[model samples]
Target: MPDNARRPGTDSTDRVDRTDRAALRADCASCFGLCCVALTLTRSADFAINKEAGKPCRNLQEDFRCGIHTDLRTQGFPGCTVYDCFGAGQKVSRETFDGQDWRQAPQTAQQMFQVFPVMRQLHELLWYLTEALSLDAAHPLHGEIRRGLDETDRLTRLPADAFTDLDVAAHRDDVAGLLLRTSELVRATVPRRKKRDHRGADLIGARLKGADLRGADLRGAYLIAADLTGADLRLADLIGADFRDAQLSGADLTGSLFLTQAQLNAARGDAATKLPSSLSRPTHWDR
Candidate 1:
């Protein structure tokens, strides 16, 4: 069976434990063409062409798989390669819609497209909440993380219209505050060091190899194509950090705050890169 095939007793509203990583990871085999159709892209460095929302990409297959899945980067679809739906595509496809596909039931296509992005945001929060709950140093804030995780999960299970109408940004703000506290709590254990504030700094293509970035505030910083090889990123606040094409070989992110899979996938890494147990090494990383 596929990785995300429906397990017995698992339904749309079922609440799994926060530590269940399988539920939080993207299960492409279980997803319909949600990402290919629901998302809009503009022609830029990230995308080779432009596409409007609710329209299927030319490369999307009738079976709901990308035609250029193996060569997306080479085929000028690098953005697609870096995108992660955080398991929302599968949940919205299989559980929410009960395996009803947009192609078969075109009437529901509009609603499905609208709900996909909302559910994607909720699931992203679930990823962060789940990881927060796993931090031993953040035990005191486990209650907050659990509450956020429950609420986020509940949001994902809502009906399509309800999910679309949700004020996801407001919920994200609430969860962001909690995550900030969680970061502070975890980083407190690290020995006192100079606090580096690189929030929103543009370090694109800059050389940061082997730099000490411990306890740095890198929120929203653009590090695209930055050479971060062997950098010490322990206890750094990496919320919204752009790491696309950054080199992470031998870099240590053991306790980095708010690092997402999408960010990791966008960057280049190797087996020597150190990461928190909650996050997996990107498959593209060189072994």
Candidate 2:
């Protein structure tokens, strides 16, 4: 169960089910600025300069807020604006470390840094699992999805040492298997080819405007800066597709499988971008 979760075995526990899902969204207000300190950033199109892991970002304030929060994209930190930890930062700060601050508790800094990433992977899995359970086409796999969600949620509550020793990759592999099955089950309902496999394709800067990509398996495909304007992406499997800077104006993503909020945030969408009811239009999208 999550922080305020009630008894889980009751028929009337649907309220907690929604809260459990909401907990996976990034909650910066409850975090300790973990991402700014624990993740490495290199000077590139996204970041202004280089910063190593375990070092606080120069723009991180004493109150754990970004110094230039509002102007991150204009200040060459567009990467920060797209990154989401899936609420792992607050879980580590409030649950694992019991509200300890790395700046004040210098002795706890190293362990906290190590645990943050581990918790992040677990939370990301939780995000996928929660999404899987909501798919009506995946009704057959709801039992397995719930079990996976519960297990992943429990793992997020582990202590610092346990997190440091956790085999997150192995866990991710197991969850991936489940998600793949869920994707297959859901996509089968759409009238596309049995296998629209485009996994890991180098589609960067591809001019795919108004293409019919419905029910395509684009898992992990490099779609960076691809022109997908007005594409028919209904029921497409976009589990790990990189949509950074991709043009999605007038694209239809209704019933898309495994699409995440982070991916949508990275892409450029407009008022004409048709999204599933589960996902909202990116705030930066042209209205």
Candidate 3:
């Protein structure tokens, strides 16, 4: 199964306009609660109970809103807070299905559930491609990034039936290649000596407090519960890095690459945690 959904970020150095990213952020108010029903919930720290795919959560109201929206963490459903469908939920609900919700048209439920995930992957790629195009450092590959963005956007608009046969993995690989180049170009601005490569490393619970990790390649690194207090991570490539329960207090991530709001939502941080202007501080951080 695919991982939960997410979104993108931008900053002052971004070349792309912020208004163009409206379709990349989740709009729950315009959705049909697809995430609540389409995703399987395991009985873990993230969820209060197990829920099978296509089955609505017990907390789902008739209006397609979570009943415990304000108290999700207190109700043991913190996982719901970090999930971002990258605006795929509404696209699937309104565009793909013509706004016909599962409750009204039970026959469409199965197909909608299957297509939702595929649409999400396409949308996630769009998020990354959009962010890549925004970075001034990636200007050398702007043409290629734009092409990838256009292609991914086209894929997202494909007919729902076309999704079943779509080779998303291949497309993702193609996009990943472009993003890798983007990461390299952006991180190169930092001094060669300061560039730390920890790609795919197992650093769970590692003590990295106040560490100088500027321009580090931390892709797919396992940083669960790691201490990153006051760490300097400017311009680091954090794509696919697991920051769950990790400490980000006072960490400087102003120019971090591929650092999404979902990642920040999963980790612990405080008011002093510096972030890119494009990303917002998680409300839970204050609590």
Candidate 4:
């Protein structure tokens, strides 16, 4: 199966990451290279080489860095740039064993490696929960998000020993429910106009290819079957816009604010469609 479920942090330098990345960096560098030693990878579309968990790659530098840092994409290792440790690697390295490189304490190496995935999963939860709080238009979800944030924070603060023993998957279910509700609340804010006020609205398939949807407020608009190929959707406020069965092939939604993945999944598009990074092209369009 394709690793379609990407852990958050695509735009690692995006606003959400920038806000707290300094703190993460501080905590991570003190790490004893846990991520380098603990994770495993298979040669796949994203990863160019395979690595065993706990065994550092040959290209790993003396400072526990990737030697191909600058030319990741050019050097056929784009996956490294795309992957975020979610702070787990650092936490394990520093807090788990007092920053002692597992190489020195060979007996603890196996246990540290075993706990790496668990901490990675918890850190991923923190990433999602943190992002959920930053959406300004998601006021309705503010309270629930705070709770999730608090819980995520608590888990992230666990010392290395407890972190290693964490049950990551079981904890995810609790947070997933809150995240789903948060998505609903955010999307619900998009208002449906009474009289199809789709002026400048970027319809996905209604013969609107190459149309202009600037300054349009398409709250809950049923855009299914609208042809929005090559449409200009920059600065469009598409709150709760329905994209079910919409033909958005070649459409540009990059600057369209408030567009959610759930909305995109409900819509129809093909391989010919150009989507925002936040959203994925529907699989039916895959060759």
Candidate 5:
């Protein structure tokens, strides 16, 4: 399972308010260790061992807590630390299943596992839609965003059997179109001369230290290990941009669109890294 750890909210200067995002965050204590058992863990730099789907990790305790929770990175499970189900675990574990754990009803284990990923995707859409609705620049599309949010939220509450045949990809496509429109509206606030488009660009290990990337379209960009130190990413559309091992020390990400904590967790940063008030400074950052 991804850590999805919570931090205190800072001053508000971003798109979405923290209070509105409380339910979007993962609450592992209220969950049934669904991520630990339902997801697969391939042996890699991110994982210490190979774990098949639906099998509890060896470190998972009887109480649904990770035995090595405090030292997952040192234990070669860094990948687990960067994952966030957007609060889908507890929704599926408690509300969907009515607090009946898989252990208590072994017959429902596989069904619950199947519904989890679907719910996670829905929750992720909710996260994005919520953020989109909060953007003043996207005000013209607020009605549409609200409809999308309500429909996505409704899909999340569907019965377990409904998920088996749900066409989630189609729904995601519909939501993605709306988000693209929202991105266009928000990024238009930046001057045309300052806008850059790097959508789906391969920027792995690129040296962008002190680069000016304001209002850039970086959606789905591969920024793995990129030297982005001191880069100005304000108002950049960072949805789906992979920040794995990216250096963000002294970088400014205030008002960046669709940036998530999981991406920040995978990157390296320092005290000088400026983030939106909605995000927390990763504890692993250099002090």
Candidate 6:
């Protein structure tokens, strides 16, 4: 193996930018592991040991190597596998800084790590735009998606030095608005909505357990405080939709389109229910 590992499992999770899956995997391999050095997490289900931002884990060996990667789950570090670097991480580490190791820069590592999250947000927008273009039903939103993609691409080229000053949450909200439009266009033909557009509708406190929501368009819809236990969400386009405070227990979300683990993590769900393979049930939901 090369000093940099490139296993099939090693490909950066770029589903947010679901274009050219193979190229996206290469984009991940091209990264210098900004995630490993930039992020900090306390010991928990996801991470076996506490790691501070800018401080490399004891298991992270020299030359960007992980000492127990193959045995991460057994070694109690399965959380690493669940995290996605979105392609910006390695680029900022290598391309932005010209391959200067964070360990060497020392003073700049924290700022670089901080920027990793910002870049991930931009890349996620790029991912959403790319996927929107791939949808034949969403032709009406093509121009908008292109515009968003162009802007997000520019975000990727920002100076790493400026990342520390970025307001990423606000930027994410802006792009999220357009992504919502694209989702509506894509699901316009789905039969579930009837004449009622659920766009931005509040479905909170509804009794929807075991409902078949297949092929539904749920862009930015508020599902808070809803009981969705056992609801079938297969093939539902759920971009920017709120699942917060929703009971997804026994909800069948298999094959649901465009749903990320981050979205699921922020929601409440049950263990007997199915979820995207990438996410585990929240501890609160396991009870």
Per-residue lDDT of model 3, residues 1-287, tens digit only: 01122222322233223236666678888788999999999999999999999999999999999898999999999999988888889888877887899999999899999999999998888888888988999999999988888778767667788988999999999999999999999988987646488999999999999999988999999999999999999989999999999999999999899988899999999999999876889999999
Off by over 4 Å in 6: 1-29, 192-211, 217-234, 240-256, 260-287
lDDT of 3 at 35: 96
Better of 2 and 3 by TM-score: 3
The local distance difference test score of model 6 is: 0.66
Cα lDDT listed for each candidate: 0.85, 0.84, 0.87, 0.61, 0.88, 0.66
Give the poorly placed runs of model 4, Cα more than 4 Å off: 1-30, 193-287
Instruction: Provide the lowest-lDDT 10-residue window in model 5.
Output: 1-10
Off-target runs (Cα >4 Å) in candidate 2 are 1-20, 192-195
The best candidate by lDDT is 5
Model 3 is weakest, by summed lDDT over 10 consecutive residues, at 1-10
lDDT tens readout by residue for model 2, 1-287: 24553233434333226424667777888889999999999999989989999999999999999999988888999899888898789888887888888988999999999998888888788778878888889999999888887777767766688876778899899999999999888878877455677878999999999988877888999999999999988878898899999999999998788788889989999998999776678776753
| Comparison by TM-score, 3 against 6, better one | 3
lDDT of 1 by residue, 1-287 (tens): 23443444577334746547677778888888799999998998878889999989999999999999988877888888789898889998987888899989999899899888888888888888888898899999988888888788777767676875689999999999999899888777778777677989999998999999998889899999999999999989898999988999999998888898889989999989999887888776853
* Ranked candidates (lDDT, high to low): 5, 3, 1, 2, 6, 4
Write one digit per residue (lDDT tens) for candidate 6, span 107-178: 767777777777777766665676667777778777777666666666666677777777778877877777
Regions of model 5 farther than 4 Å from truth: 1-19
TM-score against native, each model: 0.91, 0.91, 0.92, 0.58, 0.92, 0.67
Residue pairs in collision within model 2: none
Residue 286 miss distance in model 3 (angstroms): 0.5
For model 5, the local distance difference test gives 0.88
Pairs of colliding residues, candidate 3: none
